[model samples]
Target: MNILGLIVEYNPFHNGHLYHLTKSRQTTNATHTVAIMSGNFLQRGEPALFDKYTRAEIAIKNGVDLVIELPTMFACQSAEFFAHGAITTLNSLNCIDSICFGSEEGNVDILYTISKILVNEPDEFKASLRKYLDEGMLYPTARSLALFDYINKFNLLDISKEKLLSILNSSNNILGLEYMKCLLKLKSNIKPFTISRVSASYNSENIDSNICSATAIRKSLKDYNNLSLIKNVVPSPTYDILENKLINNFEPMFDDKYFDLIKSIVIRENNLLDKYFDVNEGIENKIYQNVFTSSTLNDLQLSVKSKRYTLTKIKRTLNNILLGITKEDMNIVKDITSIPYVRILAFNDKGREIIKAIKNNSDINIINKFSKTSFSMNDKVFKTLIDYDIKTSNMYNLVYYKNNQHLLKGPMDYYISPFYVKNMCFKK
Candidate 1:
């Protein structure tokens, strides 16, 4: 009954993901695996290449037994919040034995060490962090410098500054660190494991190898408009499903698709743009000022970008505006210790058993079929979270199925059932 948990976006299931999945299961010898996946929007502040349901189906088909949607509120957020939501969801399951992630630095011990320091934030570290922040460096860059300064001054680990910086600067490693930090923050008992990422880096656009990054795969699709170009990098099911969708005229979404909508919102809500989450420190002014001249999402982001705010951060803010996720909404759930519900996206036969186990072992609600009256309407936190999830799904559907009006039914979440894969066979 050992269950392994994975946190993933799986924008398009690829060979790298397949390898990580196989190795993680082998390493843990788990009987069941569950993944907490991002929905339509991803942490990188972009809509997924394919929607969540398609991605979840591909995940189950590939190997994972079950896939649960990470709430939209957390899906399009920073690493800390994203990890917090994911780890908390898995923790709520109450049956997970271990959680595995792939990282540039494969050593869990090293990542754990860094996570502890970050979670504790000692006096010296905090002082160093403040100093770097005061210097107007990006948060990630400042944190990296502060971490190195604190670690070097105290002679914490026998690692060079260059090596530590390399570890801190990597995308996967940053996520891995946040995962560990969240695990510690929750005092969860699930063991953590990490496997070294092979070949291409996280943001690498080179597709020379079979195990290239998801970025590379997406780049190939964007450049050539052909799935066959990435045939070598992704699994068979990924290729088949994506190809089928394309053949049926299902256009994959990119960030730019919502540029006009975002610009309009920025203009209409110019005075009160600060109400949205992460639209702080007068960044709203920059966004509003640029909206009139910015032609694309990229142009707006670049116009709003500064040393203090990264492109990704600006994109996340823009998405928050589009989703109408207000800071007040975040405040209402600030003290929410656990996820209100576990929403299943896709599952296999083995996943049914896991669901039963969850029902027996945990008290959290499991949402297999969403309806307006399924949960308590009196609960403000619950309402807020569920409303955002439904709203984001509708918005994603609006853009995704705009060309095909027939598919744009009202509130897709209420009618959609968790995708089921009968007689599932694990891919080798």
Candidate 2:
């Protein structure tokens, strides 16, 4: 089945995503589309606007045939680690033929060249990069300068301002390149595909006429009640479902129930703050400083904001705060490359068949109920994840004020229940 794979958060399944899914299939002969998704939390470290099951359902409705989670440990961290986790998951799947992603610059050779430079790491390259950073340039600016300098000297890496601007201007494209770097490192069977993004900006805060950014959409959803903009832009099925969900007294709930827990972890145990994944360079101190003075998540972020600390970095920082992810934990995460197993959230007939096929001839454990598993490592991790799920749902159901559901409402129940499944009408 020439399977195609995508690593996505789908936060709310916007138009740009729909385009990417359609283009992914057009670029591959893959019979099935598989996505390794982020769970409740996302990479930049913020709570997903919608939960994982909802996001996965949206992906399935839009195009994906099967959805497996990119575990919370990796899903909510820095790009390099996130890429390592994602690409490793793709490699472990053991069947994906190609991995498709959206990039601002669609030049495969150029991206590959840049990927090689990042990996091979010539001695002088690090020196030059260090020198640039010492001069107070942000990491992105320093990295870009280093690449441009190398390209201009050899006239090979393609340093044209237009070309550089094409990819470096957006954070998403930066992460996309990291994915390429990680893929090359793994040297897996999955071929790479990059589709140039069209008609949408990643962080634009305004809803464009027809092509709106997810950031803008998220802000609008939080700030306004009229979703005319969303109604006009999101795919019909998504639009209908989202509308029903919100209109039926369902307030848009975010994953913030453990806000105090994060604060407590950050402030109570100074050393524990050092445990979060990617907590480095005195960031634990930053959390210590912020947690003491802040009362809300927004305030905590504001207290910690600085030039070297990008918002995305802050997001990940907060994530580490909550997860207690430490640098040592990262070391533990790095040694494990292959995905432990494929964690299914929801599926239809095609998805069912795929599961059946895997069961008939698979080697790895296929966990239908991560809640029930006793696979030592998975048992512990899955327990914490589902706990978070039930907590978030319980909290969200309250923010809208319909009922006060218990935080740990499900566990022998629908705590991690696959939200919904839409039967696809793929051409026979």
Candidate 3:
């Protein structure tokens, strides 16, 4: 069973993602591909353009064999934890032999260099990094400058090194490298490989030249006529699945509602507001000041803006606070001892075989039902208030959609791919 693992967030699947999935299959020579995808919120702090299930549908239609949702707890985390969660999930599957990722450089040695800098900061490098930080530079800028200084100390910034550093700054390679580093640190036996991504910018916010980022896709969703822009970028089947959804009343998440809840949580934590993740450097005071002054979420963020921190990072920190996670929670998550719980959102006949392999496996939690899901929401409320020093949100009415799994073993999985289903090709 030569299975390959992919860490993905097909927030809205596109042609670039399809390309990566295809390349992953060929590179690993694997019969099955497993995707550990993000759920609800993305790392960028916004709800996904569509829902995770829809994205998984796109993936399964395109090339992925099995789709498992990465739990919300780990999905909206920093890259280190995100990668850790994904690697842990893949390793638990027991049959996964290779991990394929898209990289800007695709050279293991170069990524290892940056990984060393992050994990093993030498004295000169630390001093250089500190000097840059003291100058009030943003973390990325400071790290870039310090890295250059440190590399120059040893006359190592040759053209190739410079190119690799530039690649490290590119979002794809940074994530790809982090995946490798996580696998390395775990001491897992899975083989790792990279496939260079093509024709898509990680943060591009507009459709151009048949390539568009999820940001671009989401921004254009309301424009009906422009939905074709996405149609051209995803696999024909995946694209078809999206046409009706491109501009429908189906709301995946109520961001405004989440914001109001966040504000309430902030206001109620008057005394312990300093304990949340990213609530440092006087950010807690800003949260307090803004909670009283601003009525909207964006307004509160504006009140706390600093040159050193990006607004997105600030939003993520706020989310961490809302979730009642602190540096301590993060520390504990790093040492979690459970296997990844795989939940199928959509799949093909090939995916069935993958499940068959895990059916009797005694090593990990191959869960198909939700009642048996660990980490209950009820327990989190207690943990949040007691451990993370934060107040809990009111257990108001919540939308809990039962998953649609008609495709599990029916014709949808056997024949109708994502696009075909969207196109009505398999309709009776």
lDDT of 1 by residue, 347-389 (tens): 9999998999999989988888787346555878778888888
Sort the candidates on lDDT, descending order.
Answer: 1, 2, 3
Give the number of colliding residue pairs in candidate 1. Answer: 0
**What clash count goes with each model?**
0, 6, 2
Cα RMSD to native, each candidate? 2.1, 3.6, 6.8
| Candidate 3 pairs with clashing backbones | 15-233, 237-419
lDDT of 2 at 255: 39
TM-score of 2: 0.85
Highest lDDT model number:
1
From the highest TM-score down, the ranking of the candidates is 1, 2, 3
Error of 2 at 373 (Å): 1.9
lDDT of 3 by residue, 1-428 (tens): 78888888886787777667777778888877778887656676655656665777778777777887665556766776777778877877777798888776766566666666766677989999899999998777788778777777776545454664597578878777677777666767888888776665777777785666766776666444465656766668666766655444343343444677688788888678777666777777777887878878878888788875668777887887766666766655565534435656666777777778867653555545433445454544323322221021111113212133332332122232232123211100
Pick the TM-score winner.
Answer: 1
Error of 3 at 232 (Å): 2.1
Q: How would you encode candidate 2's per-residue C-alpha lDDT over 1-428 as one tens digit per residue?
A: 66788888887788878878887888876677778888767787877765566677777787678887776667877777888888987777676788888777776677877887888877666878999999998887888888777767778764686677566666667777788888877877678888887776777888766767777787887778566668776887677767766665555544354577677777678876666666767877887877877878877777778876776788788776665555654565564656556677767566766666656644545666656555356554344544443444343333433432344353322446554465685531
